[model samples]
Target: MKIVITGAGGQLGKELLQLFKEEGYMVFPYTKQQLDITNRAKIKEMIEKIQPDYLINTAAFTQVDLCESDIDKAYLINGIGPYYLACEAKEKKVKFFHISTDYVFDGEKIEPYMEDDSPNPKTIYGKSKQLGEALVLDAYESSTIIRTSWLYGHEGKNFVNTIKKLARHSLEMRVVHDQYGCPTYTKDLGIALKDLLTKPHGIYHVTNSGSCSWFEFATEIVTFLKSQTVVIPVSTEEYGLKTPRPMYSVLSQKKLNSNGVSLRNWKEGLHEYLKKEDDENGH
Candidate 1:
């Protein structure tokens, strides 16, 4: 089967490319230079050329703070881009798989968020993603929207890499303890997406089981690296930012479970990611 992945240079897109290649599928991974998703004409041109059976969109304007300041760019990339891709995919009779985020929720619920939960985004980034999800679902009934959270991998500028860098260079670090969510390894998510492609389509929450605060995640990184860096736990007020992050964005995997596909715990996935990074960098 022919598969097309947008944001080919991003961490998740790269992992998907690797997984698809290993699975012996004809995969066309397109970076921003190859095909700009925000441009509807370009998106149509590329999809027409590839004529893929599935279009897995991993592209987005992910800078949360930047999105708060630059709402236009955020909507263009995160909202309109996915809308255009879904329309083209529907016209071509291809299954569209659009990756979304847990930020779609307002973080008010104490329990894990189920798929049927109504979204009340508190940030511009979250609002944009919610718009994207709505557009894709409205345009294509066969589309699969996977809402994930705290994504990281061996490659990319993510929380794990940031913590690792700080541990390597600084004597101490302050991380937010109030905000909580599941940390998803991109490679595992990539494999999960590949598996989901073969199954029935619908909305699914695919993240590694379990949740943790940024402080806890940072502590784990320091422990794994055997670093002496002291990770200080701080509340959200102490680490105040322009964008208001979800205090609890833990997604329930009951939907993926119902589909008979769920990933392992976040810590286990983190261990494998760290090991892979160490091996690749000759650590």
Candidate 2:
């Protein structure tokens, strides 16, 4: 299987690229600098040249707060970019996979969100991502859209790394406890993505099993590392985030399970991730 992946420099993109390469598939990776998805001409030219079996887009303006200030950039990258890519992929008859976020839904639901859940985005980032999903599906009905939450990977700036850094520097860290979501490891998600290759094309919610607040997530990391940092739980209001996030963004895994694909629990994924960090650092 030949796959062309955009945002190859990102945590998820990097993990996917490595996974595909290790699986012995012909993989082509493009960073945002190399292949701007917003540029329709460039996207068309590249898709024609690669003729990939699958085109996975992990590119997006993911900064939740910054997205609010940069509305145009957010819409262009997070919304229109996927649409442009989907159009090109459709033209070439290439199977397209676009990564989406849990932010698409409002935090109104207390239960896990299914694939069919209606999105009522509360922030610019969420609104932009929701638009991207709609546009992609509208452009190509056969497109596969994967919605994930609280993703972390070894290759880039993610919550895990951020927490680790904070633990090392600060004695106490305040994390928002009110916001809840599944913490997904990019590597695990990459493996699941491979399994979805032969399945039906549609939106799939893929995340590590179980959910936790940001405080709990950070506490896990500190405990694993045996750090002295005190993790204090804070509410969303106390955290004073400039942008609002879905307080309950746990996406359901029923669709993925029905398709014979499920990832390990968040704690397990995080433990392995930290172990890898330890190994790399010669701890």
Candidate 3:
């Protein structure tokens, strides 16, 4: 299958690109510099040239705090960009796959969020992403939307990398405890995406099974590395984020499970990541 992946420079996008290439599929990757999805003319031009069977858009203005101050840029890139891709992909008869986030919901629910849950975004970043999901579906009914949470990948800046770095230099680290979500590995999510290639096209919640607070995730990280750094749990107010975020955004993977694909636990994903890092570093 021929696939065109936008946001190739991103963590998840890079993983998807590598996975597809290894599977012997014809893949075209575009970094934000190469393809600005909001530019309708350019998006159309490039997509026409590729004529891909599927267009997977991972591009978004994901800086949560920055998005608060730059609402226009957030909506333009995260909301309108997917709309443009959907419009063009529809004309080409190519299936559109969009990566969404758990932030779409308010995180008020104590249980894991399902695909059909009503979205009440709490921040500009969440609103923009929620808008994108609606726009893509409205533009093309056949489009597939996958919502994930707490993503960390090898190719880009993520919680895993940041924590690993901090553990080495800092004597102690403080992480928020009230907020909870699944820590998804890009490699695992990439494999899940490959399985969804021929499945029904609609919104699906995909994440590594189980959930934890940022404090727990950080503690796990240090434990895996045998670091002496201390991990302290703090409340959201104590953490002092510039933007409002969900306190509990764990997503339900029931939809993905019903589709006959299941991701392993988040701990397993983290273990695999550390193993890969060890191998790469010749440890």
Candidate 4:
């Protein structure tokens, strides 16, 4: 099996690239510098040449705050980029998979969001990603769109690493207790993605089981690392993020479950991630 992964430098993309390669699959990875998805000509040329069996796009404008200021760049990269890839994949009959976020839905629902739930994005980042999901599916009906939330991995900047860094110095840190979402480890998500290859193709909510608020997530990190830092809980208003985030974007795993796939709980995934970090650092 041959797979092409975009945004290879990203946390999830890097995890997937390594996972696939280690599993004995022929994997081709491209960073933004190597293959800018915004360039349609490049996408077409590459797809035509490789004719890969699967093209997974993890490239996205993920900085929520920056997306508000750089609207054009956000839309171009998050929206049109996936569309261009979908079009090229369609032409070459390549199976397409695009990574998306929980931000697509507003925090209106108190319960977990289903895959079929309508998206009512509240931020520029969410809106742009929503557009990407729509465009990819519209261009190619057989494409898969995996929606995840609160993703963290060893390879990139994420909440887990940030908390670890701050805990090393800060005695206490404030985290929002109101906003809720599933904390997914990129390594676990990558394993699930590989499982999805033989399953049906469509929008699926893939994340570690269970959910928690930012404060709880941070607390978990500190506890796992045996840090003395205190994770103070605060409301979203007190946190004062420049860009608003979904207050409750926990995604349902029903679809993934029905498809015969399920990930481990968030805490378990986090423990493994921290252990991996320790091993890498020679701790």
**TM-scores for all predictions:** 0.98, 0.99, 0.99, 0.99
Model 2 — TM-score against the truth? 0.99
List the global CA lDDT of all models.
0.92, 0.94, 0.94, 0.94
Clash list (residue pairs), candidate 1: none
lDDT of 2 by residue, 1-283 (tens): 8899999989999999899999999999999999999999999999889899999999999999999999999999999999999999999999999999999999889999999989999999999999999999999999999999999999688889999999899989999999889999999999999999889999999999999989899999999999999999989999898778888999999989998998999999999999999999999
Error of 3 at 279 (Å): 2.1
**Superposed model 3: Cα runs more than 4 Å off:** none
Could you give candidate 3's per-residue lDDT for residues 1-283 as a string of tens digits? 8999999899999999999999999999999999999999998999789889999999999999999999999999999999999999999999899999999999999999999999999999999999999999999999999999999998578899999999889999999999999999999999999999899999999999999999999999999999999999999999898888899999999889999999999999999997897788898
> Candidate 3 — worst ten consecutive residues by lDDT sum?
274-283
Worst 10-residue lDDT window, candidate 1: 238-247
RMSD of each: 0.9, 0.8, 0.8, 0.7
List ranges where model 1 is wrong by over 4 Å.
none
Candidate 2 Cα outliers beyond 4 Å, as residue runs: none
Poorest stretch of ten by lDDT in candidate 2: 238-247
For each of the candidates, give the backbone clash count: 0, 0, 0, 0
Q: What tens digits encode model 1's per-residue C-alpha lDDT throughout 151-270?
A: 996679999999889999999999999998999999889888988998888888999999999999999889998999999999999898667999999999998988888899999999
